[model samples]
Target: MAFAVSILRLAISTAVFPIFLLHFLGLWDWICKKLFPHFMVQFSKSYNKEMAAKKQELFGNLHEFAGSSGKLALMEVGCGTGANFKFYPPGCRITCIDPNPNFEQFLIESIAESRHLQFERFVVASGEDMHQIADNSMDVVVCTLVLCSVQNQEKVIQEVHRVLRPGGAFYFLEHVAAEPSTWNFFWQQVLRPSWFLMFDGCDLTKESWKPLEKANFSKLKLQHLQAPLSWKIVRPHILGYAMK
Candidate 1:
């Protein structure tokens, strides 16, 4: 029995070592960037449908900010593949930002299909520091499923607030921590380390809404719901608009 257990352990180590090495060497980042967008299509479809009405209520009439150009200046931090483009209101000039440059190709393709949105630029920057965007310049700032992976959630929220013009809205949709006593929460804790390794720094146990509630948003409207996703671990979600 002891000999059999030793062999099984060795086998497991042999299978996992190569993946650990790939992650240490940054190849895992490349793999995630290349494949995560495609993997998210079905989830995005269900989420987009569920949140369509809320998005319309938030973005439908932006003419209020349509200064001389008649277009709202919007920035999407961590804009992976521009998945939210189709849901945006008309006449929006969008600036996309992400830490992974590999997503630029996929983002460009998404933009090509979104004829209603005007292309501003894609910047290789992390949400924690968006100095490339001027303070008080954006009419709206949007983020979807991004905060959980950021290095510092509070800093990112502050940067989002800083970049938005006075009265501009910051729209966000994110998966957050499950209830403390739930079985899902227990699994979230158990699976977090491996999940983070495989999914580009996403933390399954992050209570992302904590920082949002603490942020200095002049007006905040947040709602929590279980997203229609096959993965139960990531089903708990929060979506809302915060006014600066």
Candidate 2:
């Protein structure tokens, strides 16, 4: 059984590295737009429903936060291939930051050429330092699947808190370590070294949740979900909203 598990892991890793390379090369755009927007949109739509429901549940308690002033100043930390561009609400001003300048250039060029756009504005830099966004001014900050690769998660979380207005919301999608999964635990431990070095220091099992809870968010709306076929090894995600 152990030998079989090892072989399976090797096979998975071999297949996984190519996908990582595509992400590193920022080629998800070509794949999503040319080859797979249909599948991508469907998956995102499914997640959006669940995420929106999570947000709506606490609308009453979070009126001040959820109630935007009809104008949104948004930021996407680690924007990747700008996948979240399709998720933005109209009229929201956007600024996205990513360490990979090459990727950022690609994102800007894509937006310039593309027909459909959901973001209001876009920028390329480190999200940990939103030196451009004024303090207590932004309406919403979209941080989907970003915290994992950040070197200083605490610093960035603090920065997010600092930039948000008194009632602004920071909506996030994150993957953290899973519970009670022995094989998953092993994979995280075994691959910790290579995963980080190869993928901008993104550890599959990094704990980015506790600090967010401890942050200045007045109300936190959080949910966890596991992906279908991760061998129950890779942590799936938690989509949540926190208000300043």
Candidate 3:
């Protein structure tokens, strides 16, 4: 009976693998490019206020920064629905980078609601490759819940460093790998593959903060905490700033 069950599992795995590949290449991209942004826009509204308060506290000294006579050149990588716009200082000019073009409309709507922030440009490009943004040009770079899904996190960090001016800071909030000994960690690892496939490459168990700590940033201030109880599989989170 056990042998028969093993054979059945093997057959199921073989059957599912091909379809997964096809979907990952085509349908997955479509969903990520289209449906995901709409879902994220609404989802962000539900929890952004709480998250934004935490972000404000973490970014204590920098929260009210209005760069260079109120013309801050801020760039947000993966600025999903512009959830962080309200936290920005008044009269700041923002460059939004997101891989999903569908997010532009949402971003525009959010910008319209913002009192102090203004849109400069929207680039539909991955964090790993943002050559259009020149080196050492931005006053600040913001990334939240982004590093977990990028193709190469180290490369994305490098790009963030390259684009930031000396004394500029990179603000981040990301869900990370849970404590290794915990049951949550086990579930995180077990769910990672399916989670990645369903959620646009988000890896539930990625130790995203390790690369940030190892990077050549001038200073790193970070704190780790568990997210809300509802986010069971990806609850471990890190938030802070890395100065360039």
Q: Which candidate is the best by TM-score?
A: 3
TM-score of each: 0.85, 0.69, 0.87
Stretches of candidate 3 above 4 Å error? 1-25, 63-66
* lDDT agreement of model 3 with the native: 0.82
lDDT (10s digit) by residue, model 3, range 1-244: 4454456545654556754675757766675567788778777876675566686776565544445665778899999899888877777789999998888898888988996777899999999999999999988899988999998999999999999988889999898999987877766655565567667788888899899999999899889997663567766899988989
With candidate 2 superimposed using the best TM-score fit, by how many Å does residue 234's alpha carbon deviate from the native?
3.2
Off by over 4 Å in 1: 1-17, 24-27, 34-69
Off by over 4 Å in 2: 1-69, 113-121, 229-233
Against the correct fold, how does model 1 do in TM-score? 0.85
Q: How much is the lDDT of residue 217 in candidate 3? A: 100
If both were scored by lDDT, which would come out higher, candidate 1 or candidate 2?
Answer: 1
Local distance difference test, each candidate: 0.83, 0.63, 0.82
Question: Residue-wise lDDT of candidate 1 within 55-130, one digit each (tens)?
Answer: 6665565556554566889999999878789888777899999998877878888899999889999999999989
Between which residue pairs do clashes occur in model 2? 94-121
Root-mean-square deviation per candidate: 4.7, 6.3, 3.9
Instruction: Order the numbered candidates by lDDT, best leading.
Output: 1, 3, 2
Model 3: how far residue 145 lies from native, Å: 0.2
lDDT of 2: 0.63
